[model samples]
Target: EKSSHLSAALLGEDCEISPEQLYELLQYAALGKHHNAAQPSWCHIYHQSRLAGVVVIVLHEMSQLHFYKFYLQFKHLRKVFRHRFTLPPPSANFLASLCGEGSGLNPQGTAPGLISTGAECIPKSSGLQCDPIIRKYGKEKRGLTSYTLTSEELRKNDYPMRDSPGCKGYMYTECDLQRTDSSPLFGLDCEMCLTARGNEVVRVSLVDAEGQCLLNELVKPESVIVNYCTRYSGVTRKMLLPVKTRLPDIQTRLKKILPHDAVLVGHSLNADLQALQMIHPSVIDTSLLFARNEGRRFKLKFLAKAVLGKEIQCKQRLGHDPAEDARAALELAQFFIKKGPVKILQRALKDVPLSTFSIIQFSLDPEYVASHRLVGFCEKVRNKLTDMLTIYAGPFEEDFCLKSVKKEFGKCGPIQSLTVVTETYQPYVCIQYGVLEAAQLAVESLNGAEVAGSCVKVQRPITAATLDCDVLIKELELDIENEGVIYVAGIKKSLTETDLQEEFSPLKDLETLFLPKDLQSGKHSTCCFLKFQKSQSAADALEAINGWAVKGSTLRSRHALASGHLWRWIWQMNHSSEKQGGNSLSEKMAPLSDSITASHLGTSLNRDILHKKELSAAVSSIATPQQLVMVPAAGGSVVLLHDNTFIISQGEKTGSDVLSAAQDGTKHHIFYQKKKYTDSTASGGFLMLFKGK
Candidate 1:
């Protein structure tokens, strides 16, 4: 019935055909006969000899038929015919013939109401059957088969009013192809913004499956005042300013360049497509493809890090570069293609064999479990067999030493391997047993036992086919015990030997002492040492002095009283007592002090000045060693004892005798208070360079 209505429409009917006539005509056509035994009472008055008038009358009769009843009958017949005939039903091919050379309706030309062909014409065949002549000469040859419907079919089928019949939700069908020769795999990256002007796109980049960049352009928005935080795009206002090219122009250029049926690859393609207002059917969303059942919230960078073992550092400033982003999206798509579809989280659980016999209790309350059992508990998690085991052991030990533990655990179970997680406060061990029973035994017996002196915990493991064992080994090698010793420089000048020694005395009791020697000649050097009694103490000391500062005046004043002055006065009084044959100076000078009035006191003061100046030039000019050597003192002010000692006086005036004695080493004697003292000044306990006589 549908075929008869289509045929009558093609014949340019003037009146509608009834349901009864249409059904009879279709039955007759299918049977390869024109005998209408049950024809409707709608015959036109026209002679067959006048074919044009007869054709017009037949068309007028067909046009008067009731199409609604005919449609219902056609649907019923389709089901009945399909059930009766074991052969495949005729498709759109039956209708194709009537419109083209394959149709047997065509007749020799010069006759009215018939199509005519010349020497170059292809012959027509029967409309109800596949015409051999037209099939050989008129079928579509080199190019893609046209899936487009004709105007008559469109009107009859109510096309263009509904969605395209061939389109699937997210997939492209052959009928949707706008280009035939190009590859279907491509990538897209877009930058969008909502500004004061309006919603607009800022940039778009395209890349092929091979990671070769194809198109990159900055699009100009319709208006300005670009908002910095343009949703998740990370495009800022500076990037949109003075926009490069008009958005519409860029879109037009892109449409011309891109294949209509290509698969679009991107991190979040839905967002990009929405931004660009592109309605593409074929798309590969990396985020969607890699999402775990844990949630639909997988980040692109995280997926890349886990799957590819490559870190992608996202730019924190400004707009994202279109070319780089597009390439990354393409790379992610390619990785998934090579690695196969990501396994669902629940499916990964199946890969991990559960131990039936060793049922361990897991608590959601970490604090309560930790306090009661003295053992840590992790939430029951679903991971690959290897990964779960690794995570289970991670709380007890480092991953590197897991092999040794695996060997020991294999005695109870057919252990394949093990992984220890060092991230937890307590060590965790994950064991992969060859059998589920062995895994059960291991988890039951070793869950709270100590392995290699550290508490051990057991669980299942996780595995990914693409996970690199060699990379894991490299990471394990870096987990060995590391001892770091940091050397710090740039100490303050005022820091004295005693100050440093006292500060680090606690450390010095633990390690050896090695002092730095000064290279230049000076009483003031910028370094000191606190030898630790132990190596660990050195580490502690280093931590303490990492940024310590010395505070106080560095230079001693010339006339100010100091501890050295009191010692010098006592030494003089002792020498004076020795000269008096054990008589105390307080008693000897007691009687003379009243009247004698010490006539040599003035001369003695002058002579002391001359001795000090002679010692200054020789002592201060001497060259010292390169390294500053700190000598440990018994108990006194931390003095920097140089090789040479030049006495430093606190008084403003210098005694003449002492000054002259300092200059002349030939006669090293000096007179003070009319007493003759031996020329023993050079013989005193002083740090000095000796000259061989």
Candidate 2:
């Protein structure tokens, strides 16, 4: 039926144009091609996703991407500006009225058709932050369980309608959702007003599967209503002060109306449930349901426009109509079911035998890919996973999923994606090996191996669109080779950043200096990092600082393994050295083996600054000879950290999640999970350095 409608809309009754011509017309419009023009001079390629739930067409011209992207963004910016400045506001009378279709209680209980007679709520088009044509891969069968219907189908269904007693009681009797089965599906929405404690629910709207209002009411709060939130909530002092409907009555009413097993659908459903103090197992949050991997959930109105091809939440003055919100959520659920379910949340337990969820979960979360630290690792892993391996059912009691494939060949090389289809009875696994040899090694070793009583079959599978994996791995690598970090410690307590910068402003290749402090650490020791554009300049400055003492501790510098790993060394400076006796770390100091070389350190200065006897005493320790040389390979540049440890990784082990979210995470540091930003000062402890004269 849909195909027929589309065909008629395109070809017309007499078939004015050929189907090939129609296809070309669409291509020309999409690619911004002109009539009678050959494809643009630039060489380009196009690919598309054949997934059932989503259709993604990707076009690429190595030379013209940025040019097109600029225009695309500019177009979106125009929409945002129009939405902000050009959208008309509603009249004062409409603003003061209740959001009900009746404008209040109606004798017939039939609310007016949506707020359309005077002012329509729909937008002219999509604005900034448009929903992408995205859908997750899953085993959902095409035959719809529910949420698919036409207006005729919905009217024919034997569900309750506006005249139904339950529907008659609601402010409006409209049903937008349709389900054939007796199993219950209800859409719930709530509007909250400011109360003494916080925001409290002032209105609730519940709609049945067919969108006939089951319940709609304004309830008085437990505490005094502080602000009506008249603009957004639409609830005014006039609606709640009379207190005709109390919280208890609404709670009791809902208990009787809502079934235990009914599937609840709503946007931001958690807040509604919390406001109601309701515990429900079956819920489909439209916000979460429509959430794609890269984009955040949309406002109900924006979502309606983008996904449902409808508009909502535009009437600002009439308090929010719960019935409208509920209908929107119910319809949104139907829209989600029409596409597919999100299965990413059902991740398998770590290292368990491969299940459907386990296969996709094996790859790092997209968050890891977005980080500077993991890009190189991702690139290396992708380069190795060029070959594919197929795992066919063998003597294994279970299906042919990664049953023992990983155990058998995980050592062969990194496995990038282990695609498994266990939902079907005939299960097969597609394994993308990080290295071609790894796949070959696995095929050679495991093809005839006996497992769970049967010998498993292994071979390579045909491949396509591996460019996705390539794109995944082709993120920016950390630029550590060209830059160096200086570890300056024992900064005077009295000095501010201005004082330190003034002293070190002459250093060449100086990029930024930052002071870091542990938010949880009460210790007041000052430490800072000096980042330089050139590694050689850092080396020269470190050499100079070693010969002269600043404040108290010797200044040190070293090439960072990567840009973001500075915090690991800073963590070591304050915590690790103290754990090991400070004296022991001082004893293994790399500089003690070399003689002082600074000509500026004249005799009188040396006597006052060097404190050789005190230094010797500080270096003395009862540790063994093997422990004496256990210094890190920074060439004795670590002035504060313990001498023995090597930074094996700067990942979860360092409690990076906690540190990166710390008070100074982005400002004193370089990044954020929510955003990427930088400043002149490095975040965290403070360090001081000298400018080159």
- Candidate 2 lDDT score at position 598: 12
- Per-candidate RMSD, Å: 40.0, 27.8
Clashes of 2: 27
lDDT of 2 by residue, 467-516 (tens): 33223222111122223555454455566777778777878877667554
Question: What is the C-alpha lDDT profile of model 1 across 64-124, one tens digit per residue?
Answer: 0122113233444333321110111223332322222333433231112122111011111
> Whole-model lDDT, candidate 1?
0.38
Q: TM-score of each candidate?
A: 0.25, 0.31
Model 1 poorest ten-residue lDDT run: 555-564
